[model samples]
Target: MNIPNTYGHLPLAAEAAGAGHPVLTWAAVGVIVTAVGVCLVVLHRRRDTRSKRLTPGYDAATGALVVLDRLSAMTAIAGVTTELGELAGFISLLRVAEARSPEIPFGVIVATLDDYAASVFTANYATRLAADPSLLDSYLALARVQGVKLESARTAITTVQRRIEKLTGK
Candidate 1:
């Protein structure tokens, strides 16, 4: 049986003519451009989401805790260092809760424990992280702490919501 070479010789003709080379180059460029555009759009959206999640109120509370950590590490601070240290520790726990929780409303309630506290915590936390060159360890620690807090907060919120539903009878 003899098979007809309809498009089989196209490659040979392309090679001989060299006319298809420019077309191939343009196609490649088009593909690359499209890929890059998609990547940029994805990256931009991720950045926007992160920024929104890490709001100023949230940052402040976390920052104060970080500062307290640093101050505790250093000696010759003002009076009531231990008390301040404890307060900072508490704030840190709260920040951890905020970071891990997906429920935004609860996080916002925790965040608004006075704007000053939130700002201080966030600034200190950011500064401490910035100063430390090794971030992986800190990030992992924060993630773990946040996860526990998140679960606890979620459970508490669910319980409260259930109670409200029971009372309202809806």
Candidate 2:
């Protein structure tokens, strides 16, 4: 059955609009996300590689070596006749370096340094008796003992430095 239309035909306009194709937009977003992720990964790996090259306790090791070298020089200049105050100063420096040394890498050297300090401690105290001609010979013998200890510590430090260099590829 045909019925008369109650409403007149009205023209409605529709406009088409879009930023771009959906696939291209999504693809661009994915590419940007992937690039950002890759950059972050590269940055992280670089930091790790740099840290590996640096090596842990490297500064401490070098610092201890410097202190020991200084002490060795002072001992060489002063010999067995080192003044009490100067000997005390060297002992203090040694103890400080030994305290800061890493337990794993420098333990043996630290022990050797401790022994060196012990001998120096005795020598420092025994210097008072050096005025006695009879005790002078004994003091010289003690000094010889300290020289041996010092050499051992130096050897140990050199070994550790070589190991650290090998590890860090430096």
Candidate 3:
């Protein structure tokens, strides 16, 4: 009986076919699977560590204070818009912190931030009303309301910061 060498030109292919390199192929697959599994585990650990660090703590409190300070300094439409963008980012951080640790009293502060945003909206509306001189009193009233809301939010953030400082002993 004569066997034809179908892979006459490819020496490696002929040798692999005769040798039936099933073990080598399985070993390569096993190595690839192990590499992928290791990568997934490492990625999972990194994500867990990052999330743990982001949990509401001293850093978050300090960040809130900074955001609040910047927010308070903004008066013009452009400045206010920028500050509000920062505020929204800060709120997202707080929300993440809240999710990580439900024990923390972030709900109330989050609510305060919402109220602050609403007051800013009110102020924006009042500013638009400035075009109508007849609405001067209404605009002034809204401005005053916004000022009060700012103070309230500032107070809330400061209180949280103080508590965190005391807790951390820093």
- For each candidate, what TM-score against the reference? 0.32, 0.49, 0.57
Better of 2 and 3 by TM-score: 3
Top-scoring candidate (TM-score): 3
Clashes found in each candidate (C-alpha, N, C closer than 3 A): 14, 0, 0
Candidate 2 deviant stretches above 4 angstroms: 1-56, 76-104, 121-127
Worst 10 residues of 2 by lDDT: 76-85
Clashes of 3: 0
How would the candidate models be sorted by TM-score, starting from the highest? 3, 2, 1
Q: Per-residue error at 155 for model 2, in Å? A: 1.1
TM-score, structure 1 vs. true: 0.32
Candidate 3, superposed: residue stretches over 4 Å from native: 1-56, 76-80, 121-130
Question: Cα miss at 55, model 1 (Å)?
Answer: 4.2
Q: Could you tell me which residue pairs clash in candidate 2?
A: none
Query: In terms of lDDT, which candidate is strongest?
Result: 3
The models' CA-based lDDT, in order, is 0.49, 0.60, 0.68
Give the alpha carbon lDDT tens digit for every residue of 59-117 in model 1: 44444445444543432122333534454455555556466645544354344332323
- Model 2 residue 2 lDDT score: 93
**Model 2 Cα lDDT, one tens digit per residue, 20-117:** 46788789999999999999999878756754544444554555556566666544333453443353454454445445544335566657766776
Poorest lDDT segment (10 consecutive residues) of candidate 3:
71-80
TM-score of 3: 0.57
